[model samples]
Target: MARTATAAAAPRAPGFLRAALLLLLLVAACRQAAEENVVTELRCQCLETMKGIHPRYIQSVKVTSPGPHCDRTEVIATLKNGQKVCLNPESPLVKKILDKLLNNEKWN
Candidate 1:
């Protein structure tokens, strides 16, 4: 009976070791994901932006302010052709569009 008990305990030692190692790996993976989240910019939607796009080609505009995912403001425009493009916030054309959009005035 004692020998049988020892054999059962020996099998459990390897099983316990495997479970502990798996838990350790899971923890490390979680830590890596948390670190990636902390860096930000990974989730920023805009990859390329443009300037000097005429407002007449734009059907609508959406503005996103700086947040945890991005450090700079983003201006996205939906063109009349149903395509989206990122606009440069520093561009004079974009500023004028923003003014027209915010003030709800007809674009001149």
Candidate 2:
């Protein structure tokens, strides 16, 4: 009777572990999707905010990964004047400041 009980329990252990692992994987995927959406949104907003600037001074806008995780995406702007600015999406204040610097009407 003891040997039969152990055999049944052994099969159940693997099933429970697999279910837990699958749940964890699903949660991770959802989190990654959300992070990607946030990055896309931030990129679009940066572009719109900088559109008023002179086209001649704006060379390119690109998304760069600052780290392993996609949570900290840097929006890099290259200027015709040989200047580059990296904007961090993690900080609202920094974004506001960068917007003013890059899109100011007085900036050449």
Candidate 3:
């Protein structure tokens, strides 16, 4: 009876401590995610702000949402110099532009 009680007591203390540590880690991750995203309202659509760029200087492209009422899947072109531009991917002209940039082909 004494040995059984000692073993049970030892495991329970460590088990509770591990659970507490895991809970703390999960809370920290949630807080960090919430802080990283701050949304604002935009009066205009995303495509209205599109600009032209030379394919040679573009490094990569990705999708991001800037605000509500604007297109959610708006494409962001990242230049080699760390500058970024918003683009409307649904347009035929923009598609041609991205294809030219990604394929490393001359834009005619």
Candidate 4:
């Protein structure tokens, strides 16, 4: 009886740890997905805003949303010349334009 009880408790300990790890992984994945969504939305907005002025200037786009101290969003555009331009979503100029282009009801 003592041995059987110890065996049952051993299995339960690993099962509980596995469950906790799975939950932590799931939370991390959800946070990453949310950040990616925000970046995608911002990139689309930037592309649309730049379309008229630059036409085909933007060759590629990369977005980074760093943690607390850094800005919430950073968008890097690769130009035809292999040069890159970084745009901070927190910047005044970027915020103004994005607000006009993305959040405005007129664009819809």
Candidate 5:
């Protein structure tokens, strides 16, 4: 009787664990999607608040241009703390840092 009871519970244990893990993964995916949307909205409004790179916080950058002119370019930076900022892609300082990132240079 005892052996039969343990065997029945063993099969259900694995299934229960799998269901719990899947639910956790689903929750994480939803959280990330919502955070990305927030980042996009904040980045769009960066022109008013962001003046330059928070050097210590910068994680990566993306460049976009409204026209052929460099002056029209926008550099969107995703910071280490998950904040995003938009700055002039034409700036020499920004260009240097961007070049380092793009070139895959080793950190000093």
Candidate 6:
């Protein structure tokens, strides 16, 4: 009777410890995932921008207004060849194209 009681108590202690360790690991993983998601959302999409891309080469334009991630307006142009380029918002040609697109509501 004494041997069986000691064996049962020993197994119960280790089982409880294993369950606690597993719970701690799960909580840590969830915390890491949440932090990574927030970091991704905080980063800007455009890293480099071009000054003078011709309107004829552009297939479409997407203008993103400044917010939490970036402070300035972003203009992304998709070329006819399907390559995307970031356009300088302050450029004269870019401004003209933006005006045309806005007037026609052609920007995505």
What TM-score, computed on C-alpha atoms, does each candidate reach? 0.59, 0.41, 0.43, 0.36, 0.45, 0.60
Over 8-79, each residue of candidate 2 has an lDDT whose tens digit, in order, gives 999999999999999999999999998986664443333323323344565665666645444455666677
lDDT for model 6, please: 0.86
Q: Which of candidates 3 and 4 is the stronger one according to lDDT?
A: 3
What ranking emerges by lDDT with the best candidate at the front? 1, 6, 5, 3, 2, 4
Question: What's the best-to-worst order under TM-score?
Answer: 6, 1, 5, 3, 2, 4
Q: Residue 24 of model 6: what lDDT?
A: 100
Tens digit per residue, CA lDDT, model 1, 1-108: 999999889989989999999999999999998998766455567888998488789899988888877888999899999999999899998898999889999866
- How much is 12 displaced in model 3, in angstroms? 24
Candidate achieving the largest lDDT: 1
Runs off by more than 4 Å, candidate 3: 1-48, 64-71, 90-92, 101-108
Query: RMSD for each model, in Å, please?
Result: 5.3, 9.9, 8.3, 9.3, 11.1, 5.0
Q: List the residue pairs that clash in candidate 6.
A: none
Tens digit per residue, CA lDDT, model 6, 13-105: 989999999999999999999899656456467899999687888999988889887888888999999999999999998998989887985
Candidate 2 has a TM-score of 0.41
Q: Give the TM-score of candidate 4.
A: 0.36
**Model 5 RMSD, rounded to 1 decimal:** 11.1
Provide backbone clash counts, one per model.
0, 0, 0, 0, 0, 0
lDDT (10s digit) by residue, model 3, range 1-108: 999999889989989999999999999989977876774334433545465566667778775554565546677778899987777677676788877767878756
Q: Distance (Å) between predicted and true CA of 55, model 6?
A: 1.0
Candidates 1 and 2 compared: the better one by lDDT is: 1
Task: Itemize residue pairs with steric clashes in candidate 2.
Answer: none
- The C-alpha stretches of model 5 lying farther than 4 A from their native spots are 1-46, 49-51, 67-71
